[model samples]
Target: MEWNISGQDFVTFSRFVGAALAMGLAAIGSAMGIGLAATGALKSMVRQPERQGEFVRTMFISQAVAESTAIYGLVVAMLLLFTTGGGHTDGIHGSDWVNGLRFLAAGLTMGLGAIGAGYGIGIAGTHAIEAITQRPEMSGVFMRTMFLGMAITESPAIYALVISMILIFVMGAPDAVGVFSGNIMDIARYVGAGLAMGAGAIGAAIGIGTAAAKALVAIARQPAKQGPLVRTMFLSMAITESPAIYALVVSSILIFVFTPTDAEAARIFGGMDLVAIGKYMGGAIAIGFGTIGAGIGLGIAGGGALDGISRNPRKESSLVRTMFLSMAITESPAIYALVISLILLFVFAVPDTMSWAQGWAELAKLLGGGIAIGLGTIGAGAGVGIAGLGGLIGISRRPQKEGAMLRTMFIGMGVTESPTIYALVVSLILLFVASSDVSTMSQGLHDFARFLGAGFAMGAGAIGPGLGIGLATRDALTSMAKQPAHEGALVRTMFLGMAVTESTAIYALVVSLILLFAVG
Candidate 1:
């Protein structure tokens, strides 16, 4: 049999794919997680015959919690499949492609995000069983910790849901005439917005999972210190989840805040030429990829801190304080990316009439600015994680010298973040100060070269500071652990070394700024 498919039919097919992905993937995850939890609980009940009723009750509650995300996905899928009038004559309006892409992106955002939440809940539930089995007397505390961790792990899934809702109800609304209207560029923008939040949330899921897993292991090891451990775990989870929040903010801005006004859309479709779609795509990539490193760093630092506190409960307060500071410092790079994305989306306006060469130059500038901030921050995040791990280890080994270790860690982290600051400066220059004098294709090529140079300057410069800060932190921690009494002097010396090492990053920032304003 031969099959004939028109363009409209393809749009219809895309809608079906979106609906299936949204509900099917989420349901699979929920089922797998709930099944794992039930199995683990049943096994535990068999081992502890007297607590069968309690195990069954806990398992049911956990399954209910895990099912909520899947239900949300199902609701969204149904709406897309049955309620949307994408196939109607008036609804197509040449915007079927945009609607199809929007639906697909929305489904991916919720569907993939829920997979992580499901696995996270399963990990937490499994560990909860082990913890309760080993320390029945502290089962109450274990249950509390497990629930809290699961809730934290579910945050990225919630972020995805919000993005999906925005895509469906706000952007794809039937009444919003001409919103999609066959503008392929606008359709791409919507797709980018969905990915900005959806793909970005992946790191948060992994980070939360790691933090929760560490918390359960710590509880199993030291059930008596569950209070402090749980507190620290929650705090770290909050910090770990921040990158996803940043992505959500960017996605919201892209969906509802940034777009062509009705008048602007009319002008674009009528003869006036404008080139700003690249800016939206650039902004999305900046926020989406920028947070992955920060998420991983938070996980490493938070998990290490929890482990350290479990080993030496006497240093709980000091260790937590140090971890908080380190996480904040580590987040600076992601913050820089957010700032750059906002500027790209809202501040930069394309000229009403421009040569193709000038348009290309503008695209290069926006993309270069994004890459400068996004790739430049990854190393800084890793550096901060290393410093945090060192601080945790030092405090656990020498509780009496926490003050000195914390001071050293702060100085080292500041040094590590200097490169990110430099990248921020370079990105600012590329966004606002770079010249776009492109009368010919050759000039546009030159402009592109300058933007690319600026990006590399910042990205490459970030590497040195990351390695330097990690080494400085390691040495300081080792010294404090070995000679607690000399902590004060060691901390002072480490600060001096870090300050000297940070000068290289500063030089690179200067060169990048020069390339932006002068060369480009």
Candidate 2:
């Protein structure tokens, strides 16, 4: 008997082939676009070295726009394969092949559009840089305009992606078949996703490189404002990084969630559905981005605060409060990410259950853990804010007496950080330990218990004493500030206090270790 593909099978195969073509073709166009744009910008900058700032700002925005082409191609291909009924082999229709080809046409449209947008953005960046070199005074204004232009340039790519996704997912797939095509296809999908993330990496490297070069030039010109300029550069670069991270998150979701797996592999992926992976990855990225933002915010806040203190040293308390508020706001994103991570790892990661009772039981444990940690971070955030504010105030009032006040404030902050640490510990236990079926009394448990407790004991135990010494230093500074003539006496008292506090945290570490490793 002769073997021939059914109408449905042919359509499904065609859709897959189209997606591969769309991605491959778009990749070539994007590569050429990027090279052209970058080269033009470099030439412009070289010609007008004095207009470097304007040129760099323009170039950065241009490059961002150029990168959107690859993003477009990616979005189009995903939609074609996953969304469209053209990929459905269960249906019986002679029109399946035509529908599949139509889907392919949609991909082609988007792919070509991406190429044009990429080239346009690149050219825009090149010219903008050249313009800036000639008019250095208008650098800031030019930078703003450049970004606006780049954003507008990206609109077409976004539209193309939206259209392609609709064609594939909404119009094409109406009951896709052949999910059990061995593991080869799944592995290919995973590899493809991994490769896509390289585009994001490339964008990040270019952005960072450009930002760093400009920053060094700025610092060389204005050493006095070097700190603030560096902070600005870092912040801008981080914002640039957001898109790359988004790409990575999308790639990971595709690889980990969609791929077919054996019973063993299923044991890992099946623990949480596709939605859960998105949540976890999203949360992690949020945290990573927030951390970077916080660093920049803190630096800027500190610089401004120091300047304020210099002008009016007596109002130290008020200055500190402002600084604390800024820092707290800066850290909010990180805290949000932490809460989301806890929810995903604990609440979302659960075994499938046919019965309602089992499902509810799993949910209850997960939700309870999530709520507990979420609340803890809120408290931690508030405490740290207050402590930092108090420290800023104290430091501003007596610049010469900063050493002592800073010590005190740091201790207060340490105390504030403790609750958050506790919450983290609880979340980790819930995620890794409680979710697993391993019993506390098992041999595996014996190893885990010791391993965990010993690590915790050594770390947390050390923290307590370090905090105490920090407090002592603050007290000594305050005392010395009040009576400079009696500094010798204060120093003697401070050392004794510090030693006592340091000893306690150390003891806790020892006890924790003994409970973990020695007991086992």
Candidate 1: stretches off by over 4 Å: 1-10, 13-94, 111-130, 173-185, 269-275, 441-520
Worst 10 contiguous positions by lDDT, candidate 1: 266-275
**lDDT by residue for model 1 (237-339), tens:** 8888999889888888778765656654544331112246557777877787677667767876888788888888877877787788778877777787888
| Residue lDDT tens for model 2, 1-520 | 9566566576666667767766876676466656765776678767876655655655565666677677778777786677535333445442454355546655654564454346545544654465455556656644554454445444434544544454454332223232222222232223223332332233333333333333433333344554554455455445434433543454455444543335423332221332232333333332322233232223334434544444454554565465655465535533543454435533543333223322222333343233333333433343343344345544554566666655555554554455445445544453445432322335434544444344344333433343344345445544555665686687678667655655564465456435533564
- The alpha-carbon lDDT assigned to residue 43 of candidate 2 equals 86
* Candidate 1 clashing pairs, residues 3+ apart or interchain: none
lDDT of each: 0.74, 0.46
**Model 2 scores what on Cα lDDT?**
0.46
Error of 1 at 165 (Å): 2.8
CA displacement after TM-score superposition, residue 473 of candidate 1 (Å): 4.2
| Candidate 2, residue 43: how far the Cα is off, in Å | 38
Query: Considering every candidate listed, which one attains the maximal lDDT?
Result: 1
